[model samples]
Target chain A: MAGVAAEYFLEAIVIKPIRLRGKIKNGIAEVKALLPHPMETGARVDSEGALVPAHYIEEVVCQRNGEMVLRAEWGASVSKDPYFSFKLHNSTVGDKITISWTDNLGDTATGDITLA
Target chain B: MHRRALVKGLATLLSLGLLPLNLYARAVAAFTAEQAADVYRELFGSAAILPSDRIHIKAPEIAENGAVVPITVSTDLANTQSISVVIDENPNPLSGTFYLTEDSAPEFSLRVKMGRSSTIRALVRTADGVYMSGRQVKVTIGGCGG
Candidate 1:
């Protein structure tokens, strides 16, 4: 069973900035992101009848032009595909913003937004 | 008359047992070290969290609901880069992760869901390294069930 575990990989991950009012305003950017994770409750059992160990993304970071403006750490309380929204100070149209996260298994995912 | 007395005696014993059971349940909901390490690695890319007073985490000491809790993270470091919030005993471990750019404010606020009573950690990383702070919050439900 442990051998099979190595073959399992993340199914899919999605990241999108939550647009405030569905529009960009005054160089201030608001974005929300969601990542798809099983978030194994650590209280559930898998198909083989083994208790699935808790697995979840613990950290996320958003970067603009190589400078980080926001970072977060999470625990089991967060729902699966955890969703979050935050603000940036002077995001102009066409600027590149990157969001990245790492899970408990050392797996990492990333997404980007181009201000419109 | 004997039957009624026996029933009363049993009731008293049951209530006494229940008192300790309730306390035990609350203690179990508290955060553990394993959960804390897991959350730290998820947020900082490693378990290299250095305690710092620069980062500020705002959350109620006691939350009425374990489902939806309000939390806020702010920092006072220069060239501030990122801020993140984490609940130690949530079902998943990592609650929310935010990335910041030069144009980002040094502050952020959000509401998260928690499944149990646990410590909430706020982590901040600058271009150089990472810093963190935490607080324990008690969550109450119908019966203090995590």
Candidate 2:
């Protein structure tokens, strides 16, 4: 378990923290991340029957050893508490993997992991 | 015509001394688009996706809860540039698109919401061309309404 447990956030603090886990095997590094978000679609009404405003992750970027590996653009249809995973090739034991996401509300969370 | 109008509007603002630095950021047209093909065309610059067996989508045949249908997409296509997921019947059919580099593997997993039983598609944009594969998912309960 090479999970360094790195979580970073700026002002406009989000409610929950982001999680990242990673490991390298057979020249490949596998990474999994959980970004806690409401993921509101702007269509659902509250218990009071008022439409909930849309708030979801707009983009996510991943880096390997300070090099850009992946960048993703998302819409509101992604499920709540979004779970994402991806892999990297030609990986080494000490490779650092960084994941960050920005939401529609302009909130962001970044975390990193050192693969073992 | 639209570009000309936008230029004219900018000129009018400039003439009125109302020009501001970076007035408005270019909006991502595909992010809010409702149609799947249009979204694809807007984002990847192509909607004529050809069917391919290389793209593999792993998902449930029947999703008990439409709010969270888990899926994983992977492909062996060489020079893979990007992979994206599309739900045919969602209000906004495009769920997400992952742009990858040479260091990144051609595998992506994410959860998505479905308004109803719909076709889930995995599209691959490679150096050669755009390819796609899809699977049908039946939702017992709708989740997008919420």
Candidate number of the best TM-score: 2
TM-scores for all candidates? Answer: 0.50, 0.83
Lowest lDDT sum, 10 consecutive residues, model 2 chain B, at B19-28
Tens-place lDDT per residue, model 2, B26-132, is: 23787678898887788668446899998999999999999999999999989998888889899889998888998889998899999999999998989988899
Candidate 2, residue B93: how far the Cα is off, in Å: 0.2
Model 2, chain B only, scores a TM-score of 0.78
Which parts of model 1 have CA positions greater than 4 angstroms off? A1-23, A41-50, A58-77, A100-112, B1-68, B76-101, B109-115, B118-136, B141-146
lDDT by residue (A1-116, candidate 1, tens digit) is 55233224333334343332212679788776666665554555556555656676666677776776666555555655565566777678877778777655555678877778
Error of 1 at B49 (Å): 12
lDDT of 2 by residue, A3-83 (tens): 211221222434688799898889998899998988988787766556667778988889888988888888899999999
Which residue pairs collide in model 2, if any? Answer: none
Score each candidate by Cα lDDT: 0.62, 0.84
